[model samples]
Target: MTFEKQVVLVSGAGRGLGAAIARAFIENGAQVVVNYRRSEAQAKALVEELGQRAVAIQADVSDPLEARRLVNDAAEAFGHHVTTVVNNALGDFSFNGDAREKIQTIGWDDFLGQMDVALHGSLNLIQAAAPAMEAAGWGRIINIGTNLFQNPVVPYHDYTAAKAALLSLTRTAAGDLGPSGITVNMVSGGLLRVTDASAATPEAIFELIAQSTPLRRVTTPAEFADAVLFFASPWSRAVTGQNLVVDGGLVRD
Candidate 1:
């Protein structure tokens, strides 16, 4: 579908990869909703920079009610139905390998928290937006995931586990929603070089990842954002229930 005919709601879009995804849609002529949980300033700043095609709305996707409201608000603002969603909001997290809790030290609650936001958040958005997508006869749902689940380079147990669950939801949702013309898919990336979550990563780790990948460099948020656009664009109309890894050939699955 052409972006000009779509309204996109991107969760946690105030910064990092989310921000890049939001901008990608906007540049392609889609009206975008930059949803944020607490980054109001950053979110609003992004909207301002993008002009009227984009607007920032604060809503935590973890709550089903709020997720619905976010979609409603986006529709009202743009005077258009929301035809796309990118579930990119993350529960508080950092990619600092040195500070991550190991298998022994981490508790179930830690894993639960990640699941609550990543898995549950994706469910809430899909449930809330599916009706409109069905009515419009077209829609796209993109879930942001990680390459670590497949490679476990650092074994960020909680984060990787949560994302693994999200990947499952993406495929299952595709089956359930395909009849309505809504395609569900995932775009997984490796340790992004400059996202806020990865800001604490040591320079040596970045160098190591670059050397390990065939591309000879870590993927940038902007580059990954382009892959997300493909899923949402007309180019991928026949695709669904698939996981496209965008980590510079680090993991071949």
Candidate 2:
């Protein structure tokens, strides 16, 4: 459970679950790189709070060049060695009425937008970071996913499909990198109550979810972040290509 002497990178870490993950790593003695797109102020404040162990860098993961550049910047920050990579960034949450048109009216563009961030962005980061992690002979890759893909109670088609692809990618990457001692896994959770991305979900819906879960409460960013840490820690050395869901028993599959 100790991240001492580890260097970790969390994409889209300026706020929400990403930010929580970044803070957790920093608090555990890991040098953290907080990747963000437009939250410069938030990122800077986080860096300041985390002191010298944290760095705030702006990079859009969906863009291949920026994704690679972010890895390069992180390498320079820590002399070409990073042991952990967390793919937690997403393009946008268009669910809950953000769509101007229903699926019958919306083009495939909506789905691709979601796919680009998780699939494309994750592949880019894995490619950029794999070499270094392999050289170190120890690495951790945690892909963020959603439990909605399992339940589909609300039918967020685009988002659920994107997450499914990410889950598959996690397994494939684990298989490919297993020999190199790099473990790739996914942490899927039900709707988190406080993330800005989930803010659009109606309070009534969240209440229903809380009531359905055995825990009687919606998941929190901190709780999900702990799962990320588990996948990153030495304790999970033999576990790879696995999707560990933390949805308060709401999604048992």
Candidate 3:
């Protein structure tokens, strides 16, 4: 319980990878904000399951105004200045009713929307969380990223582009906040099989990734969450602006 009593806000935590990340923080004794956009029932259920340490809030992080509210709500819930922020939210991909939008067919609005959630959404949270971290003289900002951006196996251009932009923002934020004891880093992973959000990925693609990876296993949400916790921990005090890939050596970045 190294993080006992600490406050952590995780966006898009109603299900999938986001939910897993929230659980990890709670297990580590951090008071967690389980943020979601539409899954109210799931969010409330999670909060009850986690007991008093968890608070479920609703916000569409892709919208900058709502993004700010998520942070404020978490700080109020935890009854402390937040010390950790996990920008793990993403937009829903309908993509004009196609299975997936190709680069040529993808519209600029779709691309910007994804970027808004990954890059601008991250920035919004960071801006809201930074003042408190600076006041405390310490903080952690962990950005969730995709291994596909490192090397696209399926070629989801819009999602990949947004994640790449997030990586760029992570480094720059680290540079800006280093003197204040706040560390910003990214946790990039290959296809995660356990997350609900990833369940739509074809099984063949997952098998191919497993074969390609050095460990011959797909990275789990919990495994990816562990890497995120490391970056947020005191042990990584001297570390910042680094993309810690947790995909079992599939793509090193």
Candidate 4:
């Protein structure tokens, strides 16, 4: 349950759920690599706030070359191989139901756009970090997923489909990397209370979702981040290829 010796990398750690995950790892004693694509100011601010234990690195994880560079730079910055990776980076998206693209209107490009960041991005990071992890005889790869594919609460076709594919990758990769001591898993969450991507969601929708969950509340980024910590911690060493839903019990499987 301790991360004192772990060097962790969290993609899109400049803000929202990614940032919260970075903070959680830092609090738990892990040296964190705050990976961001465009939020330079926010990322640097976070690194400064987290002090020496955290360093911000920019890379668009969908590209294999950039992804590899991110992993290499992270190790160089922290003087340790990255022992854990949180694939929380996301393509530009918003959670407005009314503004969503319906099945009839959504094009293939829409789905590809989301997949570029969710599925391909995760694959790139995993491939880049796996060798070091194998050499070290241990690694944790946690992919950020969505409850929408399971519940289809709002039927976000593009985003949900991409996450569903990511869940598949998690399982298959887990099986492939198991012998090398690298565990791959997923953490799926419902419409988070207020991430930049979820900000467009109306308050009424949030209230409705909260009322449906057993906890009678929307899950916060920090609360969901705690579950990510579990997957990265020693307690989950025996667990892999599993998807843990942290949406306040809205979608039970």
Better of 2 and 3 by TM-score: 2
Give the count of colliding residue pairs in each prediction. 0, 0, 0, 0
Residue 151 C-alpha lDDT in model 3 = 80
Candidate 4 is scored at a TM of: 0.98
Better of 1 and 2 by TM-score: 1
Instruction: Sort by TM-score, best first.
Output: 1, 4, 2, 3
Each model's Cα RMSD: 0.7, 1.6, 2.1, 0.8
Question: Tens digits of per-residue lDDT for model 2 on 1-253?
Answer: 2598788999989988899999888877889999998989998998888899989999988888998899999989987576889999888774464433555766688789989988999998999889988987888999999888778776577788899999999989999999999999999988887888887788887899899999999989999999999998878999999999998899886
Off by over 4 Å in 3: 94-98
What is the per-residue lDDT of model 4 for residues 1-253, given as tens digits with 9 covering 90 to 100? 3599999999989999999999999998999999999999999999999989999999999999999999999999988889999999999998998998888899999899999999999999999999999998899999999988889978589999999999999999999999999999999999897889899999999999999999999999999999999999989999999999999999998
Q: Candidate 1's error at 83, in angstroms?
A: 0.2
Model 4 misplaced stretches (Cα beyond 4 Å)? none
Clashing pairs in 4: none
What TM-score would each prediction reach against the true structure?
A: 0.99, 0.95, 0.94, 0.98
Q: Considering lDDT, where higher is better, how would the candidates rank from best to worst?
A: 4, 1, 2, 3
For residues 161-185, write the lDDT of model 3, one tens digit per residue. 9999999999999999999989999
lDDT, candidate 3, residue 73? Answer: 80
lDDT against the true structure, per candidate, is 0.94, 0.88, 0.85, 0.94
